[model samples]
Target chain A: MNIKKNFRVILPVGVLALAAVAWAGSPQILQPAGPGPSTASFTAINKVFTGDWQQYGQLFTSWQGGLFNRIFLLILTIVPVVFLLHYIIIGAKSFSHAGTPIKFFGILTRFLHWLAALSFSLLVITGLMVVFGKFIGGGPLVMSGRSVHLIAAIVFCLSAAGLFLIWLKDMLPMPHDILWLLIMGGYLSKKKKPVPAGKFNAGQKVWFWLATVGGGIMAWSGYTLYSFAAPVDQIRQMAILHNLLAAGLVAFFIIHLYMSLFAVKGAISSMLTGYKSREEVAIMHSRYKI
Target chain B: MARMKFLCDVERCIDCNGCVVACKEGNQVPVGINRRRVITIGEGKPGEKSISVACMHCSDAPCIAVCPVDAIYQREDGIVLVNKKTCIGCGYCFMACPFGAPQFPSGKVFGARGAMDKCTFCAGGPEKTFSDEEKQLYGQNRIAEGKVPLCAAMCATKALMAGDANVIADAYRKRVFARGSGANAWGWDRAYGKK
Candidate 1:
């Protein structure tokens, strides 16, 4: 029974994790030199096959050589500032409010929150510099900009893994969250009454999953773009997929930003100060009371 | 310190690799890297003519725009050069080059591409003087010795000319008007299409 319970929780989580890993294996650009100007096909796996895999790999190496060094420096400098600001400034008070008279984001929850924000920022900024470096400064400036972008992307991926671990507990599906989702929309629309929670509300749980799943795709495709050893056709396909995944993340982040900053009144302050009003907690998160 | 340039007369070229050989000897360029090459179009056909090609040393060089490490820059004499000390050998300039002038030292080792090398227009390299290092790495610095490019100066047929673009173009136009039947104004365009 214990094993069964564990499997029930592990199955979806494992699949989501796998999906995330696979998605990150996609590449950005994949033009490769082919055999003697006559052959331009892209093969799978090894040399028994014939085509553009080697060419794409060669191109990838050039891309890496051109940009990785400078990008790494920028990420090393910037991400710590973002991480420290989120953890120390935004998460401190929230942990104290878990079961207090005034409630807000708990310390554990706030840690995960800041982590997600940090990873997302790094990924977005670095990814742009790599894909669009040439299009930006034209000719000479493309080189410096591209290398800065590649290094930041690697840091972003590492941070994303941390964010995933920190939020896995809340992101798992719960019976209460399902019920809350069913009625919460109507309640907010005034067609039904409100339901509350202790640690996380149904709406919050939904947001958590969105970040988790979408982030996985972004990480996977981003990795594939960087690895450089993959076959060219596969890399090209991955590049397209990665672009799509990036678009999805951008849309999701917009909603995320709105909810944290505008839609919910005390959301930003909780991440910033880590506390919420007693009345606010009672009404919004009654089901999650510790 | 005027900007140096090279203008080739496509009409007079005889498909001889004379310029290519002269350039190789003058610069003592390393093997597997051709700073200049003669490309013969219409091979084995009646309307065939071969042109010796190298870097145009463009006023707005594409290689300069794409190097991340700021490796390539134009000299006051208008010759583009790679600062080999700063070059990381990334090969972006190779990809962006329309003329394929950038050659890497790839056949030297197990596909480990070397710093990019291209035609110096006979002005030589980034070194201060005609040191052995400059000779071995970037060929002879004839310009420092106050001479035109060896290939142009040594052309037996006088088919290829190097100097100001205006002077070369004037000579080419005179030839074209004199022999009006067979003249190609856009030789490069005819060679490599806009890709």
Candidate 2:
């Protein structure tokens, strides 16, 4: 009986010893292999910040060059074509008879408008060339485009600021804007509806906001990237934000160009000559007294 | 075809900065630009380790992806290179490189960045192989001469190895097996750490 009890005690002790050995020998806990807190050299900042920043770089390298670029190119081509077709199918709305022309845009307003428009158009062309010139053999074309883009960006920024200062009060959203937007700014109506508006219509207000706000962001981000003012990660973030804003600005530009040139007759003439025909104003902007 | 790569065995690196000097000397790299460097962690302390670092020539190089003018490209042998002729000095590649491999020479007085420069794996550039222009832009074309990179070849302790990926990997595997432990490749975790 004593021997049997001793045998039981020995078995339990042996099992415990074996288990201890196995646990001790198990592979180094397989710690996630990479730069730990002590080794990351890219950022003098914290590990979490650098890690998150690197993730943005990976995202941009993959999506910005691959999917985002392709989609933006497709949209860039299709949007202008679609707008052109839209104008051709439904011709511009024109007045039956020419009436007395009234002063619509002031001299300063007209100058600023043209300046902004000219700078914006140049920026778009040069920016597009910078982004897509490589596909078309980017030697002198891209080089020139970059130089032109820098100069145009400065003009665009100045004109955008000028427009914002002059037109902020005119472009504020009113309660009637909801109705104007609901009616699709009277562009879709079979019959021209007198959409009550102030100095600027809802559509024009939307364009103003996009141009001033979006343009400001683009200029700021572009400056930040060019200056290399921020850290590498921050610069990458700025690039991404700049590209996205550019795409949005391009879309708005297409619509604005079409609406001014074709959708509403005499809108371009008013922008050019600072006057709109009384009849045209009555039909297009009935709420605003001529 | 050999898929070329560099593997730095951190345990063997003595922080002597031998690789750094060798690369600069062999390439005649410009002042204030180091193609390779040795970074030591826990210096003058217990559990200290050092590793030599350079362009890893990544599989999907971010530099190539971000180049606006298609100035950067990777060779069939997986060496990342930049074409000086096409490079616009826009510095997009510099921001995109995860390893901070791209360097810009300080141009004028006001800290303007000149053309982008980096380790070319001793593979030269897009110019004619071993031509004068290639030598002027990129340093030496040691890879074309059927030789390994100078930095790794001249390593005093043989800490840095450069060759076909499979060959170096097998050699490193054998070393790890022989030691029965200590197989941690420093910076490997950082460059390609699993999420």
Candidate 3:
């Protein structure tokens, strides 16, 4: 394995992996309750609206339309630029292509991943267009994007379920994943050191769980939006949660795409052709036995 | 220029849903969609109040801000209107609207949302005034005929007021004075002698 070329790519990828962690953990829903309305007078007025969702109606819309949208835009803009910078500076990790290729993923896994991947990518694009609908100057095109978003969502949810079941055994937390996360799977070092991981790394495991469980919740939320089974307040709450979870999923997805397609040479072929370049797997998946 | 507005006096509203009926009859609003609704708070309690809800045509409309296509626009009169052709039925406006004004007709495909249908303040959309396309798409162009919105025009008790903001404010002020509910009831003191 070419350790020299490997570490060059790891530094920025590791940096980005850490950033996604920081962002995913920062949403207000997860934040602790603050000292609110300290004054007695202010608290008196708050009492009238304390239990009413209508009291916080404007708060929810403004946050969803204003702050949440901005954060999503930030994620879309920042993630790519960081990856581009890493590519320009450290360059892609090159692996030896001379050895016999290892049969890694089977057709079932590849089919499911592609199904999930393609639909998920479409969902992201269409979802963003809808989120930025006003800027796009609402029209038939945005309408079409929304239609496509629904279809893509259905496809993605189904594929993700299959993927969840297929990869459940490998995805469960192992002792090594903790170490792998701490070191960012050894991507930071300037050496091609085998990262301590199972067949799937900590990063991939995060994607697996997020894409499955998070996707399920998002699907349910999306349904709430469509069926309108619940009251508008409840639907609004669901929408907020949906948008927040999407940010985390999109962030991890970018990392996964970057690592699989560019972080190591020929890693994408493992999902497509079902064969991985032997040395590529050796360096990136050091713990996986061929 | 008249800044168009709608004000519903909850104190006077009897939950008769006259505005709801007038809107449906006048605009031919789609089935399962309400351009105007009478929401009664504390329905059976002593302090019960009914308020008609619809698009308020806000100056800083959130629907306009969030629409992917800028489909929802406001006229110089401050009446918010949406171009049906441009609307994609994404439901962001529905979510953003405080009254939940934006309505969606069920689509032929998988019961997906069709183009958004909303209260237009009785003014038509981007099409030519009084044209067939305008009538078909937006239902009516009462504003172009130099008339008040049908719901307000036909309101038996005038509980729902629509038109120039100043006039609505004046009427509302008089209502507060008559009901002895305004600040200090100062107008009542001068006019009717303090109670």
Candidate 3 i-RMS (Å)? 10.7
Off by over 4 Å in 2: A1-54, B30-32, B42-45, B105-115, B177-180, B187-195
DockQ pick, better of 1 and 2: 2
TM-scores, all candidates, are: 0.49, 0.82, 0.82
Candidate 1 per-residue C-alpha lDDT over B1-195 given as tens digits, one digit per residue, 9 for 90 to 100 = 444556556456786788888887767677767887775544565544455667767665657765655678888767788766555445556545545577777422234345678888776677766787777767777778888888888776777777755567677678867875434333323222231
Model 1 CA lDDT for position A133 = 46
The lDDT of each candidate is: 0.57, 0.75, 0.75
Q: For all candidates listed, what's the TM-score of chain B alone?
A: 0.86, 0.93, 0.91
Worst 10 residues of 3 chain B by lDDT: B185-194
Chain A TM-scores of each predicted structure, in the order given, are 0.59, 0.79, 0.80
The CAPRI category of model 2 is acceptable
Query: On residues B1-195, what C-alpha lDDT tens digit does candidate 3 reach at each position?
Result: 988878776557788988899889888888998988776544465555556777777777767766657788888888888888888877767777655678999976678788888888889888999999998888789899899998899888887888987788788888888876533211112111221
Question: Candidate 3: which stretches are off by over 4 Å?
Answer: A1-56, B41-48, B181-195
Q: How would you encode candidate 2's per-residue C-alpha lDDT over B55-170 as one tens digit per residue?
A: 88877777788787788898999899988767766677877766667887764423545567899999999999999899888999999998999988898888899989889878
Please list the Cα RMSD from the true structure of every candidate, rounded to 1 decimal place: 11.2, 16.7, 9.5
Per residue, candidate 2 scores C-alpha lDDT tens digits across A207-263 of 898888778778877887677766666677778888888888888888888888878
TM-score of chain B of 2: 0.93
